[model samples]
Target: MSTDTDTPGGDADTAARSLAHWSEAGRAEMEAFYALATEDYRQLALAADWPTVLRAVTHDGWRVLDVACGSGKFPTALDRYTDLSALPEASYDLLDPSTFSIAEARAQLRPPFSAAREFAVTLQELPADAGPYDVVWATHALYALPPAELAQGAEQFVRALRPGGLGFVAQATAQSHYLAFYDAFRAGVRDRTPYTSAEQVADALRAAGGDVRTQTVEYTSGTADRAVAEGFLQRCAFDDAVSLDQMEAAPVLGDYLAGCRDASGAYTFQHEVMLIWL
Candidate 1:
């Protein structure tokens, strides 16, 4: 039932396996990049909102489903909220298209739930009778969804949630680093597929009949080395085989990187993310 959540197959596959670029070394490099970049982010406390959202929708224990749960970071961030050990008999359902991600999330997530299940699939592929969850969420994982399917995915979110169930999703805004960089990448590198944006998702969700709310926050990330910046961009584009030199050689990519560089020669990326809820 999934639309385009494959691990970067071919022309038939509309989405790339984004996590493919996130190997151990790449993850380390990204952490280094983030250390230098996210200090000024307004919504630094992104995970703290989960419990608040969970409480607003249902006072009962959570039957939580994390869509595209990558590396279990969202569950890790839950520490800022209530202790997972103290919550009663909660249930966790992990949904993702990556076996690697599902495994990592399972090993890393220490949810307070007494029972947990993992679905190695996308939201669109989830079974019709998976039960209306108390809370269903997709964090930064919707990037791979094709533009045409955004509305269908939004409807899936609504269908997954039970009565009064709450849902939360965080995504990079249209003007954010991810979208902007990809816009430049697609224009200059390859124009095969379009990037899915939070604005588009919000509009589609609202049109699908949900009471959607959005909040934006700013953040910055930087690096002093061009090579480091290039590596980050390559990973973002899910093409590690391509060197930074090649990227710079491309007219559009090279120009985009040039604009992102500052007087100090450090590469800085400014991002605005939207916290969407209903």
Candidate 2:
């Protein structure tokens, strides 16, 4: 749910800012994300596999701690894989840096996971003794963490999980849309922070002493609507202040967008995802 790419957040002031400011960008990104993600998922049968894995590896009962539990999409996906009656003792804990997102997570974390405890803090801010969870999960939440913070966040997840517990993370590859667009954004416009690639995250997990496994999934997201395409890139860069018109006028952005266009003139984004877990 973390909208910020593996983008390195600035000093404390930026970290402390309310996420309400990002709603416009988030909404803009989600619209484009939903349209393309659905098409890709259907084509590849790329459903989330977390809940199935959880059901297979659990004991009598367990607890789950979802870091940056972005609007609870994972929990919703979990319901599709199992019933509430099957895991009566299962408890959920939600953690996110956004206060606004905490409320959204509460609203969307259906049935079994709705009763979760909430933690409104970044992974780097999460206390070391905060958990002994059966599962520690971070979805698209870790994009904006700086290198050092990214390392700390990964260590926190490894430490948060109990012995024999599982840790899962889903993030974009270096060539993925989120990463590539940001790369272009920086090159064409101002120098913004870079996204933390999935490889870096997997390495951090392994460094934490967890036996890590990985899989790469590829997909393409394309839309013919120029408005949607422009908005998606704006939001991907986390800069809602810039308009599509401005992006087009910029020499570098214009060249980059030109490259992203297909024969049909639809803006196409090539995405490669890395799914890692222990």
- Candidate 1 vs. true structure, TM-score: 0.83
Give the clashing pairs for model 2: 5-143, 5-144, 6-143, 6-144, 7-143, 7-144
List TM-scores for all candidates, in order: 0.83, 0.83
Worst 10-residue lDDT window for candidate 2 reads: 11-20
lDDT of 2 at 157: 82
Candidate 1 on 52-162: residue-level lDDT in tens? 545565545668888887766666656543454545456788888777777767786665643388887667678787868887878777877866677777888888888
- TM-score computed on alpha carbons, candidate 2: 0.83
> Stretches of candidate 1 above 4 Å error?
1-14, 19-50, 58-61, 80-89, 113-115
Q: Cα miss at 123, model 2 (Å)?
A: 0.6
Question: Residue-wise lDDT of candidate 2 within 1-278, one digit each (tens)?
Answer: 33342344453322332244435447656565455554433432244544456666466557888887666666655555445445445677888877667776677666555356778888877876677888888876677766657777778888888888888788888878788777777777656557788999999889877789998888777889877776677657666667777776776777777787888887887888888878
Residue 155, candidate 2: Cα error in Å is 1.1
Give residue 111's lDDT in candidate 2 (0 to 100).
Answer: 52
Q: Candidate 2 lDDT (Cα, whole model)? A: 0.69
